[model samples]
Target: MMRREATGEAAPRTPQAGAGPVPAPLVASAVLGGAALLVWPAVFNGYPLVFSDTGGFLHQTLGPLMLWDKPWIYGPLLHAFHWRVTLWAPLAAQALLVSHLLWLAQRALRGTAAPAAHLGLCAALAAASTAPFTVALLMPDLFAPAILLALFLLGPAREAMTGPEAWYLGTVATLGIAAHLAHLPLALALACMAFLLGLPRGRALRDGARTAAPLLAAIVLLLATNWAGHGRPALSPHGATFMLARLQADGPAAAVIRARCPEAGWYLCAFADRLPMDANDFLWASDSPVNRDAEGRARFLGGALIAPEAQAIVAATIAEHPLAVATAVLRNALRQLVTAGIGDTLGDDHLRTALRPRIAEGFPARERAAYDAARQPRGVLREAMMPLAPLHGAALLLSLPLLAAGGLRAWRAGDAVALTFLAMVLAGALANAVATGGLSGVFPRYQARIAWLLPAAAILLLMPRRRS
Candidate 1:
């Protein structure tokens, strides 16, 4: 047992050893409630949620070789449940993760919230925020918020946790951090930001390192997994390329390429005239000469040729065009902060182009029918829910001030629990914007994926007190 600032007595850590199992009726209620929130996207989509990268993840499921574009560990987990084409297996697993996250949030607050209140908050998030969107979405996007929640459990709840609870938080932190490559940096940034912004002043730096322990473990896990799966004991090798694409988006990479290309022996020099303005199109679009040509690919091989050159260009360009670089990064981060990038994400037809052949050989026939009916390439689909995006945007905007106010209030009241919630959510959102937008490029999916945390934390702080 451990004491908090508000409660001098040791708090309940876990259930007593002799306590009976959770009530069946309570379990049923949770399932029913969870189903209500988790099924909204599937119901609306006419099938399970699918993103553009979902098929790539599906294709990489236990692939013979490792792919750095997507982290290695996530694919195997996705592959494990590929026996069903309906994807119910994976979706259920993800919903369970979300449930555990919500449970942790309530627990981190020392059971301040009642079950109904928790469910109500969940419903609000699903209806008016990005919570269900990422949960139902097939990508590892949900892990961003999951990591922050796990950090809360590890940080503020550090002393009070039972052995099993500690292990659970540690595991969640590791998986949530490792599941997505971008999350690795996001977790590191959040751990530091929370320690500085939320933790008590005594030995703050030391405590910050302790707060980041799980993230370190996750980094090691990713390296080990990549070694076992990809033959390289390292994080994703795509950082340099990602950085390159980012420079392209800002107009500096092109200048560097043109200035030093044929003379300096850089490969991108040949395609200097044809580079696309968009980072994504430059990297992934088939028509772009970068993807179409051999030299472009060769330049990026092991970052041996292109990575160093990209670094040099970025440095020199930053030296010459510091304002431009900062302006681009800030603009992209702001773009991610406000507008949700739904259109550029989410897969419907092109997924089938990559998925149908694979599933035909292995997927169950019944699932194939559902997949065809719901996901196969079609001529024209209806418009997006025009109101939902802005409604979510507005909800997020409202949460910004609420979190700010909550943080100040918590510090004044000496509420470590409340401060932890605020720190994790706010730091996660800011780090997400910087890492996802600044490192890669500003994409809607990046912001929308983690935007739910702000509102979730605000609701947790502002909810009416439950009856004792």
Candidate 2:
């Protein structure tokens, strides 16, 4: 093992002939223990956590309706694991995968894969970060951080991974990207960083393309699934509608509607008086300008029906007020970066009415009963998670200086792996904020899902370095 010291120099490389391969049983036990820690929130909750969008994803395969805003990938993923018998299967799978990735990262950063060290890292993150909560959730939110870790492994820590491990990470990255629309842009940004960071070392083209391979694969999967399900090769069938909702919430689209109303004659023009609303209201509220009908009944299809008009409105708004649009997007992204909280992830009061019926339809009696009795539905998980907010905030705040110091130290020591890992983490945070916050509305869950990585990176950076 080649150890890096405080000074900008490598200590003598030592051979470890006696340090043989770790026993398979020990590795399995460590990973299972880590997985348990990662999903502790779910275990404590008595059921896997779900969200309003979980129903939409479930319908991808379990129900007849094909959701316009959602892709078909994650729904089938849930069905594959749970077989409609238990939601716990998918949650456990996600936790195991996340735990394995964390273990791999720890090994790459610390140069050892001791079970105690791996479990300790997992325990610390479980205790202090939102990672356990994110893992427990049945939503694709867990994949956000999983994608970041996968990219870091495949990019900065590439040399440390075995051939099979690299393949597995790439597969994880591909699935993570396909799980949610926001992940595509996040993955692309990280891949671009991988290429740019490799330039000085003359591996720019290879590293960039390698890192981008999963993104390309995810795109193909998305297109194939969309076409199979909706006869559309588009990545997201009604993606423009979501963007329009976001733009309307931000005020630019409303301005366009108001200025062009009664003449430009888009459906939105009729609601120019109700110009701007919260993005969620614009998309989901029964009386929203977008979803309300002449009789005041909810017309959910209005969103899909207005998709073409939404695209036109979005284009016109961006063209007419480019500066306003840019400023609003920047503001939203900044807000998204800081609004990391576990509240939305646990709070199901608003979603219960709509989400419960889907749970009943999709799951067996036992599972449905569990869903109804879950802490989220009973309004206990939110209270249980309240104490974690300050701790998570403090962890994120402390990570700032620690990450900066770690990056500075790595730079001075010429630790390319450490430098690249830190850069990737920072870039991932920005990319995720821009992708989710700018495209969708600013939501705490969007940022909260990935916030754990900040502290994880700080801890990984502080780990003692070893040769790849």
lDDT of each: 0.67, 0.82
Question: Candidate 1 local accuracy as lDDT?
Answer: 0.67
**What would the per-residue lDDT of candidate 1 be over residues 1-468, giving only the tens digit for each residue?**
244655432333443211113354664466457646855766676666775567667667523446557676666677676654557677777877776567556645544334576577778888898777777777788788888877776765554455676678788778778888789878888778767754343435644665698889888988887688766787765456667778777887777777777887766677787653788876666655445555444323343334555666677777877787788788877777665645444445466666665555556888767767763233222245444777878898898888787666656655655666676677678888877887787777788888887888887776652211
Judging by lDDT against the true structure, name the best candidate: 2
Expressed as tens digits, the lDDT of each residue in 369-437 for candidate 2 is 888787888888889888889999999999999999899887777666677778888999998999998
lDDT of 1 at 324: 75
Candidate 2 yields a Cα-based lDDT of 0.82
The candidate maximizing TM-score is: 2
Output the lDDT of residue 22, model 2: 56
Off by over 4 Å in 1: 1-28, 84-86, 110-113, 197-207, 294-324, 346-349, 375-384, 465-468
Error of 2 at 445 (Å): 1.1
